[model samples]
Target: MIDWRQLREIITTPDNVPIIGLILAIAFYVWYGLRQARANDRLIREVEADPGRHRKTQPYEEGWEREVQVWPYLLRIEFLAALIVTLLLLVWSLCINAPLEDPANPGQTMNPAKAPWYFVGLQELLVYFDPWFAGVALPVLILIGLMLFPYLDASPLGSGYYTLRQRRVALGAFGAGFAIWIGAILVGTFIRGPGWVWFWPGQTWDHTRAVYETTRDLPDLIGLHNGVAKALAGFVAIVLFYAGAGRLIHWLVTRSETDRRIYRATSALQYYTFQFFAITILAGVPAKIALRLLLRVKYVLVTPWFNI
Candidate 1:
């Protein structure tokens, strides 16, 4: 059998590097693309001037509307941003020292070390919900909701325009998610460390352990089957409030107590404010359960891995 690691080392050596091949491949593609563009331009002019050569020759010269696609410009920005982020990550990985924790023993954990950064938000969520809800259902629902976003709000109002042309609903969703949710994740991951602690970290408090203990007690919630029950109740309450509030506002607007247009504008804000809580409740479920695993909560629902 081939020694794969040895083979990889040989192929990756400085003398045998693939960079030379990449340069040549790029040069060849540039020439080939220019040639194709020139040929296409030549064909278009030939077809436009004569009636016999191409199939669709017209009696009168057809007027053409100039169209410019914004995608190419947007694509360049996206590509540049990706490259910059990748380079920053590489520098960070090299400069920052992260020593692996002491050898794993089944019953012990290292004092300050924890799971990777991306998972901290989800880990933090467990403080609010059940493990099944926090770990599985909530995360999955959030992802599914994000994926269905375009389909759910398929308005063509701004298709030929930019953000300024879109409805307030899209704008409100963007601000809530980008400004609030994403900023919290960034602060949580970078600013907070050790024990799901919040607000000013120093040698003064055991925020890490504090966060952990609080999350652990989350699952033993009084008179609770699962966090799903609490979330469902919250959902029902919010729906009733939103319906009542929206109708009252609309009726007031009809009487000219408020501007009808302004009331309509707030309609998106009202709809989205409720959606914000709905998603949070759904996400909090599994997080709570995962926290409770420490207390030995016997969640009767079986895992698929167990069945297998």
Candidate 2:
């Protein structure tokens, strides 16, 4: 059972109050998305019914010309929204000071010291990854993946319009990734209390509670943690995961591919290469958590410099 009083107290904290507004904003965005999706679906059905009429009215290539000018239509809307946001921020600042702590003392470490709100997700990631990977490599890889997304996704179904059915795969993947980041931020902000221990809604906030348990590496889970064999096994696990999943997804999604072997090979290579990295980034945390809970596996990949 949850303690409503405790939950309310936690949410009323300065660090957590903004999340209420964020939630409401997300709800509005979802409602808007649904309305837009229904409209796009109806338009698509109408176009499919009378292809010649729709093409003559709105050509596929010159679809950009069908849009209105941004000067007033979109720009004014955005400008007014920004002005309202700025005023809200002004009021908020005047009423409440930003959450800040006193000057750091090297001698006394702050218990459960946290990063900035945006970075709290990365701080939470430290539980599953080394700092080098969580704080540095993961963020770098995410940026690189986002930059490479255009090249990876060659589909033109949702080129100039918003349609859920046309771009479900891409949007679903993005939404899932965004949700993971947001969940991490929430956990770091409210669920994590003193000493970086996870505190549930009903739990008492015990500052003196110790949470210092030695985590075990995956190799150690199977009675092997040292030597080249361990690294080989780790690499083999990752390769098998990608190879099996990639082949399966390719078969499912590309059943209508051309019979040209060379073209198919090239396309499959490109698609699976991108999928390998993206899936790794998306599934890394959940995989670690599952392993930790089920098999007590700590690090899935261990090297001299880093363990992930």
**Whole-model lDDT values for every prediction:** 0.46, 0.72
Q: lDDT tens digits, residues 104-173, model 2? A: 7898888778887778889998877778888999899878877877666656567776677666556655
Candidate 1 per-residue lDDT, tens place, 1-308, comes to 44555445433434323333444665696577546545545555575598466532223344653354668977889999999989977875686444455677978755434344455556655544456665787678667666756554534543422223224445454444433344344444433545545434222334335542322122234454355664444445445655655564345334432234434444465545435533444223332334354554333222323200
RMSD of each: 16.4, 4.6
Clashing pairs in 2: none
Q: Lowest-scoring 10 consecutive residues by lDDT in candidate 1?
A: 299-308
**Highest lDDT, which number?**
2
lDDT of 1 at 288: 30
Worst 10 residues of 2 by lDDT: 255-264
